[model samples]
Target: MGAAWETSRRTVLRGGVALAALAATAGTAFAKPAGRRLPFLLDMVQNNPGEPLFSSRFNDPATLKSYGYDGQVINEFIPPQTAITFDSFDQRIFPAGSEGRAWVEAAAKKIDAHIARAHAAGIAAYIFTDIIVLPKRLVELYGEQILDSKGRISFDRPLTQQIHRLMLSEICARFPGLDGIVVRTGETYVQNVPFHTGNNPITNGAASHLTLLGILRDEMCVRANKRVFYRTWSTGSDKLTSDPDFYRQVTDQVETHEKLVFSIKHTEKDFWRTIPFNRTIGVGKHRQIIEVECQREYEGKGAFPNYVIDGVVNGFEEFRTPSRTGPIGLAEVVDNPIIAGIWTWSRGGGWRGPYLQNELWCDLNTWVIARWTRDTSLGEEGAFTEYATTRLGLRGEQVRRFRRLALLSAAAVLRGHYSVVHPMGRLMWTRDQFLGGSDKDLTSDYAAIVAKGRVEPVLAEKALAARMWDEIVALSGTIPLRDHADRTYLRVSARYGQSWHRVVHHGWEVMLRGYAGDQNGRYDKAAMRYHLARYDAEWQRWQRLAKTEPSCATLYQPYSFGPKGPDGLYNADPDHGIKPATDHYRKLLSS
Candidate 1:
């Protein structure tokens, strides 16, 4: 509520820089590659499973032991029983008003300094902010007022509108460095119910919040001209599809004539998420309104096994292997959904804190592979955050069962059934072992069947990101000549870099579920143990591939014909390449 509590992240960031320098002194560093794949910013969020995810950057050490993440807590409802209700984090996420000049100025200082440093380092920075509600000034005038049929504000809607204008002006004025704001889940609960906002359940908010959310969104984009993002679906996720009318009414209102960057958290093509409709929305129309599909967040947070992106099979059918979608089909959908960018809510986004190990924040190669690709991932560090933030609020058996369930889910996906999965957020394993029959017993269970889910056919791993990327040396086709480091598209897509990475500790619980039919801890268990070792070796091999292979790069591919756009072919603007962007990530310690 006041500036007194606000501390510019700059000083804290400096301390982190000093600490990272020390780490470098001890020989911890990323391998500088010759040429990196470009076109997206790998915005990595600070995540760890079974613990609270945090913003641990430079000052704090990156490791898996310090943070036990409790994964992202989405609406994991059991249906009409567990529908996602709404609650306002107006209190928790934003303590007071961010509109006040002092706090605004301070926040601006932190955002700008970080962005400036990012620019110097060769990485392009896009400051991401949460949905910050307006102050009393705006609300006092517009107590949920509206515009008349003539598009004229009645009693007080215009007053509220003016407040938005002022608010947006402040935003634009304060953070030119900020690329956009990631608006948290805003609407969709017509009837109030109980749900967890990051694991802490609370009474759902009134329907008015949704209206206000729409208004905020509309005003932010229309007036401010700043990019706004919001997550639509989550666990037990069919609400949006069930009430498509309401969904259309609300989203249409916000995105009209504006570049609304909608990052749906639905990692699958199941009944619970968007039906690959993005291709239709911007296909042959305006590509600004694009949909980003993620590798399912819950089913293992990419921590389960090796994964790959095969491109869209079909927008409507069960998500399938890339090739199945028809060669030059949706992949070459004559320009429908270029599939936009990806938001890796994998480690977080569930009621569980973060799903991956904490040390992953510092896992250089993992990020290298990710960043080298032209795709957008989420981020955790804010230029200067260096502390334990994302954490696990779970306990004892609950954690155990969660892991067990996850294991079962992994097996199910491997077997081509719906584990904790759908197509958008699908999984991929090595060819040899994937077909080795380890998952041969995966029959579609009745519960998983007859639901809004379906398992995919055996994955075809014939694809590779390295070859795929190199194949695109030319767009539609033409090679891009990029030179500027300060401006590039990829910088806006990734969530990585020592400056932006977050570290949290998470453990791998490989119980003796052992081999097939090893239900009990008995003689069958012996065989289970023997096979468990094999699984370990295989798991490592897969993990290594994710770390070192081309699959990881392709995991978040954001393809475009070239740097500018369809019209920029003749524009005299200079094109920038990948190295300038990569240099941006390591700016803090770079000279």
Candidate 2:
């Protein structure tokens, strides 16, 4: 439960979002026209006020009229997997009678209306049903009385297939034009009246449940041409971010199926520390690259408004992570690495109150309209986020930072050897198994791979090194040796240091030498030559990276990196495995 998603669950389910209800609407209102924008985004949560896809925030007539929303991402589409027993965890025993069908029906209707309204408003909306969170519908199908030798519910039962098929069919049939579904990697299931709170959990493993979900995404969602969005979360079990190989495995695996969008979510803690790792992946699959912001699991929900780190700001528009606060992540991370837009959670608190500024509905409208229109100037006219702090609040700053970061992060991406993305800042945790991990390797290398069966998250650092120095060399604006400072804004800034990148390349070289050994003394000679060559060429490459890398890292410390955990395959409870990886990352930084 990366930050409990600010469950205004009580507010939403009980009284519904009343932000707009409390505002005045008697006067004639005229909304400003939306500008040309590309990326479309929306919040997915339960009981979000405002009509379905719309937000119940920003009721001011001027602001209200100007804003338009993209979509509604419904929470807990999960067929509850709450285990009556631990060993029977992955068993898909949930039946598809009233509860099953009704769950889908209710969610679909809610989304159907949301999307319809957005479409009607000339805006598009997407829906994300937690493939993991729905009632462990598996148990319902298997019958509560059944259990295997280990007293575990069995996924082998026929009821599992029935539930899967039923849920899949309902998903496609329900929302035809959904923008996409964020296929997370866990189960934070819902509780029914009869079920005990003990049945509820903060996190579920990335195992059979997630695998079933993967099957759903690839077989059903992908086949239906539905977009599959993955929030990379394997850092807990696997050192995905540090080891380029591990991160690549995931990208390749996920890319093999569906038109996918990936939100790389492990950088908030270190700020601009992760971009270099991202650029290395070369934007595989052309996946809509999403950077994560507002670490839900770490930071107290709505307790504060944390800004996107300064160093990473440069790369946002070029290689951006999505933001949940009222920040303008949408305007920042564009393509160099494509910015897939941003995700603003809670809208200053939907159920309990609000998370940032506006309500859920208003947030949708403001973000979607701004993004679709791609107009940064709109907010100055009172069209961006609902609650305007200073003249240019966080949203404005985000937009400006996004633009600047895009210029720099891309410059860095162009000239550097890796791209790091920031996911969220906070570290979130729930009691029990969801917080699973074992520190096996000194590198804290962890793995939560559920390919064949079991799932586990470990602490390991993984990185995606960009070939900007090679592949993106051409994009670097060749800078005249002197007065480069003036040209810094031209997608190239000497301020973006290449020290860490050199270290990575040097590490690779040395590690290679380790394999080569000092055999015949030739190994030492060869290593020396390689070292010398790199040493001599280092400064030149730094200039090149400075020129081509995105401006994002320049906004904060260049300690960019990446992390993966249960979220990679399981998507739910994304931050579960980041601690160990962070430990490794800190180790590297300390070194």
Candidate 3:
């Protein structure tokens, strides 16, 4: 249950990230300013320094100012689930009652202090909450009214509407300086009540509930003179593969409110690469923020530079157009602003971080997106150089070398490991799950895909990254004299990437061999053993770094993949699963 508790957690790549061909063919010229540069919003974890969201460093004015972000989506401090568990979180749970009123007053004082700190840092803070289901207490108090004839939860209920109105109104009224509230209608992890189960009352038909919630939130926000950001991430009813109508209905219904903005991923789908721009972008009259996950979960999290430069640039271009506008009409594109801000998840969306103090790579990527959002014309190379020089104190050849290695690190993962078959498919666990066949089938005819002639570039990229990593690691001792502690981070990060790449590469090799063996009615035990042992050795090697490098252990949770118990390699703890895998391989070798 240790790491396995997280097994149910899906390691998400920013879902549905579309790499617009417009960006590829549109030339890499930095965007010419079109009206106002989009504001950059950072997503911070709630409740101070901890797993998945906030680090105490996030509260510092200097830290907030350093990223050049305009605001924050401070998530989960008052999440519905957490709020219901505590009586003191009365403002969030039931702000209308006498106890709640007292609680609200007390909470507001504390809330104001943080909001003041944020405002002093020149950052507007928004409370981020998710309410897929009514809290357990709320359900008990108003279950009959909230639940429809089928025992399904309904947001249209008088009680349901009242609770939302009360919760949002109290927060907004109490903390007038707070910028706004941002919420997701789809995808909330509350206990064991499953989402997207089709028949689940709370989640099914979520678009309508979201619209109802959105309107209530907007009405309260207007009174409080704050913003309401309704994220169009999912509806729990339809997959993006064929659910444009659901998205359309949700956006169309909610976008009517003037103060409310729809926060959308750049692509219509959840975060992933190779996905093209979501058609929903320029649609509807409501302004939307292009949500970018700089701590990319799919492409090495922040272990490598999985740059979405094209995605950011394309977002700027598409928002200024009528081609992909929604039913709200093309005229709205000109009169009403389209993109409101660039929402970025600098850290924590996946199991990636408690990160090191000197996480230059993630910080650099965050800087790139933040600066780029402000000025599309910002040159990636120049941005990196300036950041390296100023932030890292890296100059001359040191900067150049860092840049080269960083670029190659990304190339290595994107080209060499990121699935070409699935095109920006999540490579975290099931590396190429979308591949047309099992490993044996693909390996048997791997030549066919290779014949398409894509493998060469990937190999070349891998070679380049390996070479760069070796060179960079070799210079660690000398680099500290001038480059300082930054060298150690780079070395650890590079080694982590290389180790990860090796495990993935060799894991595939083992699969191909095993599957091919089954096909041939023979097991190549030696090759199988070799690949498994190599995989284990590489993982153990990194485990040693995890022991020494505080961030490596804290930030990069080995629980996702390491020596693990018996299970198919579907995001299981490798540490527990590896022994069984080895024993099976040995037995098969004898057979």
Candidate 4:
């Protein structure tokens, strides 16, 4: 039965590829072809329960085609069990009469319908799944065999391999329409899947990763004739994802095949500014896809204007150094044949809550990147102009003015959120959906800045960011857009950004003064009090704007300096060594 299925799947894949190529040839004659240099322009969409439009807009076929994306990655946390059929081996893991089993069966049908829609639209669909996810009952039945001496889930264990093979085979058989499987090996979240648990299967590092990749390459690529988009995101678990040399070490060991492609983020690390470009891209023999996050979770989550086109298409000027190799931006690699695609995360990254009512910011970045990927000649400014003229109906000076506003907004974000003078060394002041100004993260960052005697410069940068935001607000009002609602949104969002940057500036000032006073042994009570008052006033003003403007993103509490904050960065009283001023500020708030 398995042999016959494999034979039939190979035949279908050949026919599908040939038909797709012919269709592409025919379609290109009429319209500009997409994925010219980068053959796979894909975007991933996950469910945002709070924002239904987030997923719906991205998943819409018209939206995908309009954006020039030839493929879509459905990574809505759809578990492997959803596609796996129950057999004797599976029954042992997920015994009959289990609620999870029933749920999986129903979810599979929904997934089938979703894939069919993608196929109907001529968009290739790939399902995303974490490796080594199994029913909780599997541990109860086979814990000893599954676990290593250190109690970590062992990937090399016979039982684990057997289950991995079974899951891959079942998914391929059940969903023959799937073009590939996107494998994330770094982290696993079993919180949503009550009945299932997952862990990184490559516990033993490169060798183990090699073993797993070999299995996937053979099973998915060779047998099933499907692609395997092996994501090189290890979340800092070894240098497999970040270090170019380390990445090559692991990938070079694997036998290269046309069906096996490496998906890497544009940054060497997770999506953040100030990090160098991922040098692993265009390296080695395997095809590669550069991952870009349009919404920018760490920056603003599309809550404010945080344009990334200039930085992404042209290397960020901030991070450029003399010793860098190859090109720092995606546009530079357009001619590289090994660079096969661009994968975009239009929305959804980091934790929730600066939920957006207006996707204008996200849409701007997504549309430009998508269009540029199709035609590399668009560049950054060209693409922005096109978007302005074609989408926003701006012409002449209006387009130029909007571009200036966007550039200023992007600059403001970098200065406000990151250290402009210093190489952002391990200081996470803001992340994902939340901004922390008075927290220990910022405190530590300020302490380092103060110690380096760069406090004044940092403050100057912050003030400049605040001023640029003011300019952004002013410029936004002058540019009369075709869409009045969009114009209002840009104006209001810029106002919110102005207020937010003021809060950041004042918040950092408070921390810098506290740290500098502690270092110099001369505490300035008057300065501290003034900055604290300013911070509070700005935060309140930002909150008021947030309440009035629907497009304004939800604000993060800037002064929540309590015990047990994110990553234990605030275990100690954040107000503790920087006292009297903070104490007075706390009292003022309480009163």
Candidate 5:
């Protein structure tokens, strides 16, 4: 399997030329309107350390162009402080002998080379940064003046504004070839940058957001003649960024410019299924781009077939609400005059693993979305079929079966991981890159369902999902592709999905029966004990499978039952309330 995979991997590496050829031959079919092509951008940072294979493949101008991307988004490659020359800032504020000056000088050279490469490939290059980010030295020196009483950087401070203006000016001057700047105000990370500390500056309200956006528009867009892709994503710190009414209020206050564009995630909230489409996308008097993640961070992260093509293009059925007539999908908004493009995170989101050894799943999603963006008339199924035929070399009935498997995989994920019984607002058993194993939320949610007398239906849905995986596994084995590697990968990934769902089912049964027993006063300790034993046995099998098949993702483990444990969900449970249940299971094990 390893040798076959290596051969198939080489075929993909050599796919650039084939992709370019197809784009040229089928140019008219997916041609952009005259004088405008919907700009498609991709962020290749799969994780903090980054994925080299992703960069090597998508960074090529040919690959990006063939994949229908107009530009590449670069962030966390170099810290903002080191992205330009230190001399650009006032000596009094930045200081000539600042701690990372030497490193800054070296970074500028590297950034220059990076931008040059992008331009040479005929692809636009955009840099991303968290707003209010600054050199650690600057924050330390001017902490009192620039930081608020809470120690977070305050945009209202005149000194903070001045520093921001200086940074933007230097960035514009340093990289003339750069196409634009993408600024994120939601979250900030300083873990990787020893010399940098940052905070979200739009803490006050919509007015505060307007203040930051105003500075960005004036500096980067108007005077510098550069594009500003202002991201309206927040970690709920500032509701104004994601709120449609507040988004309009904030954006309406700013003067609109051709260079200023609003970038928003497709979902109203974080990139999760069962959320409303962001009403903010087509709102306000500004052009907007939809952000789509190819490898859904919360949905197996490409460890299995969690195809998003159908959801992205036609709307996620799970997003349907009573107030809203129907789910709003990319196809619905792609034709809006204000909708300028699509930006895809080809890989990377959430925190950490289920890192992938193969890119087939992500590739299918990215390709389909990119193609559909160029031609809004293209159906998701047609695009998927094209990918199977052209890229995977599938023929006739094989293509039909492949499509069924891919589509069913999406349903399996929604059923296995997410709860349809609960409203979209309720929390799920798992979140962001990890599957539920010993998560306390899994037990709590099941307990809630048991109390509501909905346990039987929920278990039935999960069982149906498990059966779908069974079909997926069976279909994967039956599909006889000419490429041995593709066939092997499909079967391996399908089996991984099957094993994962089985473990989840066993875990859910144990929790459901235990909680039901608690609530009903029956306390079927024997049944609970039996299910608990099955959960343990299945988990052991999963770990062994993950080891045997390097492509499979490892499951989240339960090492302890406290706030300081590795699993976030388990740690967050109040006072370890789930302890009694676990203890009962342990006692059963000893007996």
Candidate 6:
């Protein structure tokens, strides 16, 4: 790998300009209303779900400016799963041998152009480091000794480690204009790996792998005068507890590096509701950034607006120093204080694609984050009103009604549905965990119980789903959407919401016999017929909706690996939504 160009006179002048720009924003970045002037880094990753990759609008400098992102990490640049594979268009920095030299060099030139544009717009450019584990090519080229029998990364071997260093150093050397790298060791997203295998250095521990990689990245970045961001994602065995002491120990080990910054999600878990603040922020001594996902990828798949004004505001509040008088923002008051910035994910995490189909919700939410981080005194309600009025062009009453709908939707998803869901039972609503007992077993168990007699709890869950769906339908009708696309999203969402309840209702019906046991002498014929009919009708509706609104499938049911099942008409569960329904059919037929 090589730098794209020699230091020319234009390059020198550009560097001077960049430095001056940094100096100009230094005070604002540091003070941020509360008043201490440390560097406030607001980095955003370009992973908006359903967003067309490499599209003109997405790559335009003006569009980046509109979002108010200080720095942008171009995601999937390294092709996380198939890094070793060669794609003519995909940007890759690995496979540094001569085989990849020309391709890497060509990609470098393109990357340099992007970096220059980003810098021109006053936005730092960084590539997301997705070296979850050794790709199949590396293991095959070197030897099988790279991994153990269980496919766990075997750190005892030196081959993979050598390749890892080569990849990191090559990428840094080649992309000299890049601000730094963002490392995610927890979620490799490598295909067929059961999703969360936590691939890293498996010998010492998860923490060891994280530190070693951080040290390597730091050395490379320090030499190149770049920065390295190590995310405290707690992937693999590096599972952290609520105890601050545990994070303290981990932070003590890695935070000592000067150029390395620790990035953590606002909550301990993957951008989910009800997850408490990650106390680790209170323990770190180095520069840190709190990662917030603007699009509700899984919670609602961006079909409807899922407001998180409270969640984001609460997160900053948790980290503020106690007893701070006057307008205290994060900068002014911090107890264990070296927090330097905020990292927000606009899209591209989870099983789905982009969060907002209409772009209204996405743009507003991203704007709120960028503005609020700069001025913590800005009240959430005031911010929403300003956004609705200014950005959305909504008047007084329209603004209030819009706000009401957003909050109500949030409550329905987070409190109404998510709260009642058994922790292990995700109902295909989450991407952070594998589909297991709570997802697959519960439905069958309920069917068995229903066989004997009606179960009060199952019936109650069904009613709750129906109520939520009805409320969603009612609210959707009241909100006026002029845009055809926006209106289409509402229609599909109402239908999907309704279908979800039916899925649950039918699932409960199918599980009845299992719970009834010996008392299942008589089969309830009517319930079975009604369940099948409802199930078929929902799928048929999805088909019709897909034809009318092509983006509906991706917008409504975007999964990690594309829209699941035929025409994106699958049930909410995994392996296609129809599996559970069909499995129930077999059970009923035999009976």
Q: Give the winner by lDDT.
A: 4
Candidate 4: where is the Cα deviation over 4 Å?
Answer: 1-36, 47-56, 320-326, 437-439, 559-591
Please write out the lDDT profile of model 1 over residues 415-481, one tens digit for every residue: 2222223332222211101111112212123123213322111111001111111122111022111
Give me the overall lDDT of model 2.
0.34
Worst 10 residues of 6 by lDDT: 1-10
Off by over 4 Å in 3: 1-36, 46-56, 80-110, 132-135, 149-152, 190-210, 239-246, 254-258, 303-337, 352-357, 415-417, 421-483, 522-526, 549-551, 554-583
Cα lDDT of model 2 by residue, 1-591, tens digit: 111111222222332122122112211112223333436444434432222332334222233224433544444322222211122234233233545444444544655665566556554455444333334344444455433445443344445445445555555555566656665443222332122111211122334434444565665556777766565533244333334465564455543553556655424222233333243223455355443332222221222112222222223332333442322233333433345554434332212221222122223223433433345334222332332223123444544332332233333332222212223122122111122112221111111121211111100011122222221122234422122422333233222223333433433233223222322232333443453355336535554553465431211111212232332212223333323323333343344
Residue-wise lDDT of candidate 6 within 1-591, one digit each (tens)? 112112222343344343334223321222323423235545444442222452323355556666555677666434322222322222342444545454445555666776898889887877676554544444544557567767666655665565556656656655667777777664554332211123655346545555465555555655666777777675545654334576666666653556677787776666666555666664556677777776655565454456665446533322233553332233333323566666766554564332334454555566676666555555455566767666656676766656655654554454333443233234333332111122244444444434433354444445454455555676667666556566566656665556545554554444442234324465445555555566566656655755676545342331112244442222344443334434555466566
How would you order the candidates by TM-score, starting with the best? 4, 5, 3, 6, 2, 1
Per-candidate alpha-carbon RMSD to the true structure: 22.3, 19.6, 9.4, 13.7, 9.2, 14.9
* Runs in model 2 lying further than 4 Å from the true structure: 1-40, 44-55, 58-69, 76-108, 133-140, 143-166, 177-179, 192-214, 234-244, 254-258, 266-283, 291-306, 309-312, 315-334, 337-339, 346-591
lDDT of 3: 0.51
Candidate 4 global TM-score: 0.87
Displacement of the residue 193 alpha carbon in candidate 5, Å: 1.4
Q: For every model in order, what is the number of clashing pairs?
A: 73, 159, 29, 0, 0, 27
Off by over 4 Å in 1: 1-109, 122-124, 127-160, 187-225, 229-284, 288-296, 306-347, 353-591
TM-score of each: 0.39, 0.42, 0.72, 0.87, 0.86, 0.71
Residue 436, candidate 2: Cα error in Å is 22
Model 3 lDDT, residue 207, Cα: 54
- Pick out the ten consecutive residues of candidate 4 with the lowest summed lDDT: 25-34
For this target, which candidate reaches the highest TM-score against the unseen true structure? Answer: 4
Candidate 1 local distance difference test against the native: 0.28
Note the Cα lDDT for every prediction shown.
Answer: 0.28, 0.34, 0.51, 0.72, 0.68, 0.52
Q: How many backbone clashes does candidate 3 have?
A: 29
